[model samples]
Target chain A: MQRIVVLAGGIGGARFLRGLKSAVPDADITVIGNTGDDIHLFGLKVCPDLDTVMYTLGGGIHEEQGWGRSDESFAVKEELAAYGVGPEWFGLGDRDFATHIVRTQMIAAGFPLSAVTEALCRRWQPGVRLLPMSDDRVETHVLIDDPDGEGRKAVHFQEYWVRLRAAAAAHAIVPVGAEQAKPAPGVLEALAEADVILFPPSNPVVSVGTILAVPGIREAVADAGVPVVGLSPIVGDAPVRGMADKVLAAVGVESTAAAVARHYGSGLLDGWLVDTVDAGRVGEVEAAGIRCRAVPLMMTDTEATARMAAEALRLAEEVRG
Target chain B: MQRIVVLAGGIGGARFLRGLKSAVPDADITVIGNTGDDIHLFGLKVCPDLDTVMYTLGGGIHEEQGWGRSDESFAVKEELAAYGVGPEWFGLGDRDFATHIVRTQMIAAGFPLSAVTEALCRRWQPGVRLLPMSDDRVETHVLIDDPDGEGRKAVHFQEYWVRLRAAAAAHAIVPVGAEQAKPAPGVLEALAEADVILFPPSNPVVSVGTILAVPGIREAVADAGVPVVGLSPIVGDAPVRGMADKVLAAVGVESTAAAVARHYGSGLLDGWLVDTVDAGRVGEVEAAGIRCRAVPLMMTDTEATARMAAEALRLAEEVRG
Candidate 1:
């Protein structure tokens, strides 16, 4: 069986995992989900990225929304608002609140995030070993011109993305605790033992970028000596979904498929897949010393997404030779 | 303004407060709600009795259930169960979870329960100034014959009342932290300034008894130089609502209106109101050096409950004379 390790973010990563699972049902997949977006809302620990992946693969995700539980109710959010407690910008529904509540309780009882994620997956049976990028708190903070005026202020990434709608120009995207964060129990081991590693079509700056920001994760994947393939979240100078361009600019990278592969660089990434529209840039990426292929990267549906996953695997095989 | 102070429990107290508010809309009512019944579930502080009062007076309480919000969804609870994390017996709904979440957040932020209650009441506008009996954690634990057999084991009052359905013989009802707990802010002040103090038809053993267990509270009311009147929860020889009889048995009190009034005694209680069905016990109670009256005590509706509150006030007047 193929040993696969995938570093993931929220919606985009979750949808990609769903397709990856379809593409290789027998593959031993281990996912290291971004924890930079993990937040404490109403005293409950909410791991948005981990939950998105779990819900998506477990068949509980809101298909159209690509996150949260299907057929969810916002009674909990409404009640919180009624109590005059807010940050009501992020949408956490009742079903989703339960996951956070359970997680918070476990963390309070001294269980690590990875262990809690494993326990939660027993219910979802998300078909792969799901681990948080770190057991330690590693929130992503975006530096932007203070919305209330004056100099730049660092806002939580979720607040910037969900609340501000990424309207403000991001000065920097910092994974606040990543420097001190150790890879959650299985993360390094998964990479070390893996036959292949893949980066899904997730936000390079905040999603996959945040995971790589963890001190040792990027180094481990680099030394693992396995074919490391990545699918471009950017297509034809734009993100397929989400405001990848805004954050890419923060990191001084242009919003192009070629620029993203180069951002990961040839030292870490062995192969890179760009969209058919960005086929013209394939040479540009390959010239940067990473093997490159042009594929239909739009995850329009599960089948299309699975095909993209297959293409990424094929590129990994080509780079292996 | 009457400047009435009331000692209260959960559902029964909340319902009575609704009536009390209706009876004297302009009265400076201060409710010192029982906190011994407070339980921490899912890492969230759940003040069942306090919430009951808030939701009841705020017009959000489930009319039929007399606790939680009307039209409340149990999606959070269901999801928690799916994760196999629960006591499962407590029926906390989605809307109710929000109250706990806000409260837990505030408490974790170092706010005392009293301050949190005050903040919550601002949203609830419970008409009356609602105060917790104590700021400190004072969970009620019931000592019961171990369900798994052998010697007596102590369980949280909720586990006994909700999970076990109060089936196991309760040996003792202990207000775990009352020995060291001070009256929450405004509790003693309310009692000191009151023209009259009332004990609504709440559980004599677990509810009213728990408030009295708080060291200075009972003394404050007794030394307040005001008429302190109480309504009997027992209609005939049974409680109007709740399993008050079971808990009363734990405290070695007979499940009778006369016994309950006698339990309060003439020292702390200057007057008592028994239901019309227990009218014969009125003379028996009066002979014990406390003013007693027979009145319709059934809180069948808000109007009926208001009448009961009015009757209790009337008895306070009679006692003062």
Candidate 2:
């Protein structure tokens, strides 16, 4: 009867789900996907975080890239390149495009993203309930001085990340419309009923942080009356993957394990897990009234990821006791 | 100053354009695309024929299939299958989905399909003006008995053809709203100013026929004052490719070279090409007041297709002389 809820970001979140599934195959796992990374390209809504989880769990994911499906092709993308559409930096393959189209179509047809995600998950049969952080639109836009245009303008996250390759420093990172977004159906219920909550080694700022930004979500998790444990996305002083260091700077957060644990703080986190490399910072994190543990968090393989998931679960139990 | 206006369908149309480019290297080619096959699936508007031309001329087309770009994948489609959302007959690739997304988005943003096609073409750089017959909606719906429900109902052309695999006999074919569809921008002008007009081996009923259905387009071609030459899609008593027989029956035209020639009529066609197999029918086509020519119309390769283009040009010149 253990109900576990996890908040997640893209690649990291998807990878963590893989581990969590392995660790608790029969547990009622509910994942709250970050929608801040969602982007519209070529008229299709692409929720990278959601798809990653779907592919990873469905066993269609590219084992190495940990993102798109295996054996991907670029014909459609090349054709699109010929069409000169979108922020081409993010490699949207032909096969991946279909998912976006279906999701986009469903969203346009008035289905909330959570329901759309569920419908998508049915085919993937990901063996867990997946919920979007919010049903309302909340895009991550970066305010930067336009190098080509007059003054500063908000550019799509993909444009800032993929197209520009995240070369330009982001002045301000805003999850557009987050203040107005409502928790998706089943999201709050999943958190309130959960015996434990785990933040997989997903981006603490953009992934789980974005979930907290949803009006009622953070409050619901804090009041869930259970252990809320987060594994640090940072190891020593760097992120596990992607340009998290660059994004962390945009929000005035240091790319350190201690800083991430402190960012979640006693407000929501009951326990925090840091990598062995950051064992020295355990006292600092624990001083914030959060129980802390040191463990290996790199998801090098399924076994390693599952080990990390097991450690998080063990910590959650200790915090509750 | 050879302004060649081509009325085209899908793969056949795109293959012919490759040859037409070689025959008249400097000819200003304007392709008026058929929108009858345009479909809305999962809310995204997909224009298959338009993509064929763009891909073929841009050198991104699948060399074997003659449609979609070469080296394509179905990851997105597979993912969509996992989600269980679609009519599921037409195979959509991930990379290809991006093009439709951009086009659909732009169209939603008030850009006409014609303009959207142009925007898409800029990326493909297909070296020709590609125009949809109309920007206003015109979907070719086939009347068939409801597969799940009782009685007769109109199903989308894609559903009838791809999903059902054209299993049921079509009771009626209607290009919905074509009567109200205005010729897309530049379609009529290209026809009126053409030095020569070519009808590639596209489906006469669903492909070229739909383009002509746009108001003022068919009349403009008939009165263009240029020699209008059409290569027969019907090589013998069958379509060179595709289910032209099924489509021909829907439009009440027999699947024969002579019948197709007469379907276009002498008022429109100056020269009609018949394959060597239909050489015996050439005299009958000529009696319809069209100067008919017998030639090897099989587009087996670029060289063979180019020769076919040269013969059509020579026939057009002979008729004028």
Candidate 3:
């Protein structure tokens, strides 16, 4: 069985994992999900990225929305607002709230995030060993010109993304606790034993970038000596979904697909897949000392996404040679 | 305005408060809700009795159920169960969950239960000033004959009442932290400044009984020298609502209006109101050195409940004279 490890973030990563699972049904997949976006809201621990992956693979995700539970109700959110408690911007539904509550309860009981994720997955049965990047808290903070026109201030990633809609120009994207955080129990081991590692078409700066920021994760992928492949979230000169361009700019990367590949760089990433539209820039990515391929990267549906996953794997095989 | 202080529990107490609010719109009503029955579930602090009062008075309560929110969804509870985390019997709906989350968040932020209750009530505007009996944690535990047939085991009061449905014979109902708990900030002051204090037709054992169990609360009401009138929860030979009889038996009190009045005694209780069906027991209760009145005590509707509240006030005046 092929051992495939994927480092992922929320929505885009979740959808990619669902497709990858379809492309390689029998592969032993282990996912190291970004916990840099993990937040405590209403005293409940909400791991948006981990939940997105679980729900997407477990058949509970809201397909249209790309995150949260399908057929969800906002009763809990409304009630919290009614109590005059808010950061009312983040849309956590009732079904989604339960996940956070259970997680929070387990964490309070002294269980680590990775353990809690595993326990939650027992119900979702997301078909892979899902691990948080680290059991330690690591929140992504985006430094932006304060909306009120003061000096720059660092806002939580969710605040910048969900609340502000990434309207403000981001100056920097910092994974707040990543420097001191160790990889969760199975993270480094998964990297060591993996046949190939894939970085899903997630936000390069905040999602995949934050996961790489964890103390030893990027080093593990680099030293593992296995083909490390990545799918571009940016297509042509823009993100297919989400505000990836805004955060990419924070890290001084252009919105172009070739820029993201170069941002991960030749040292860490062995192979990079861009879109058919960005085929012209494939040479530029290849010149950066990373093998490159341009393919249809739009994840319009499962079949389309699965084909993209297969293309990524094919590129990984080419890099191996 | 007549400054009225009420000692209360859950549904029964909440309904009575609604009636009291209607009966004396100008009265400065202060409710010292029982907190011994508070249970922490899923890492959220759930104050069932306090929520009952808030929702009922705030017009958010399920009219038929009398406890949870109206139009509530069980999505959160169902999701929790799907994750295999539950007592399964306590039916907390999504809207109700928000209340717990907000309270838990505030508590975690170092707010006392009383202050949290006050903040929550600001949203509910429950017409009355609602205060928790004590700011400190106080969980009620019921010792019951072990279902495994070995020996008596103690269960959280909610497990005994909600999960077990009170089937097991209760040996004792212990307020675990009541001995060490002081009245919440406004509790003693509410009792001291009151012109009259009322015990609504709530469970004598777990409701009114638990409030009086808090050390200084009973003394404050007694020393206030104000008329302390109580409406019996027992209608004929049984409790008007809840399994008050089972818990009363645990405490060695007979399940009768006269018996409950005598249980409070003439010192703590200056007057007691039994239902019209138990009119004959009034003389027996008065002979026990307490002023007693026979009135319609069934809270079938707000109007009927308001009449009962008015009758309790009339009895309080009679005792004062």
Q: In model 1, where do residues sit more than 4 Å from their true spots?
A: none
**DockQ of structure 1:** 0.91
Model 1, range A142-259, lDDT digits (tens) per residue?
A: 9999998989999999999999999988999999989999999988999999999999999988999999989899999999999999999999898999999999999999999999
Give the per-residue lDDT of model 2 (tens digit) for A1-321. 689999988888888888888888889999999999898766678898889988888887888887887877776676566656645688877567667777777788888888889887877888889898988889889887786777887888878877876677687888899999999999999998999998888877667888889999989999999999999888879987877788788888899988888888799999999999999999999998999999998899888999999999999999989
* Residue clash pairs of candidate 1: none
Docking class of 1: high
lDDT per residue as tens, model 1, B58-103: 8888999888889978989999999888878889888888888888
lDDT of every predicted structure (CA atoms): 0.92, 0.86, 0.92
Q: Model 2 Cα displacement at B154 (Å)?
A: 3.5
Give the Cα error of residue B143 in candidate 2, in Å: 3.3
The superposed Cα distance between candidate 2 and the true structure at residue A204, in angstroms, equals 2.8
DockQ for candidate 3, C-alpha atoms: 0.92
After superposition on all CA atoms, what RMSD does each candidate show versus the true structure? 1.4, 3.9, 1.4
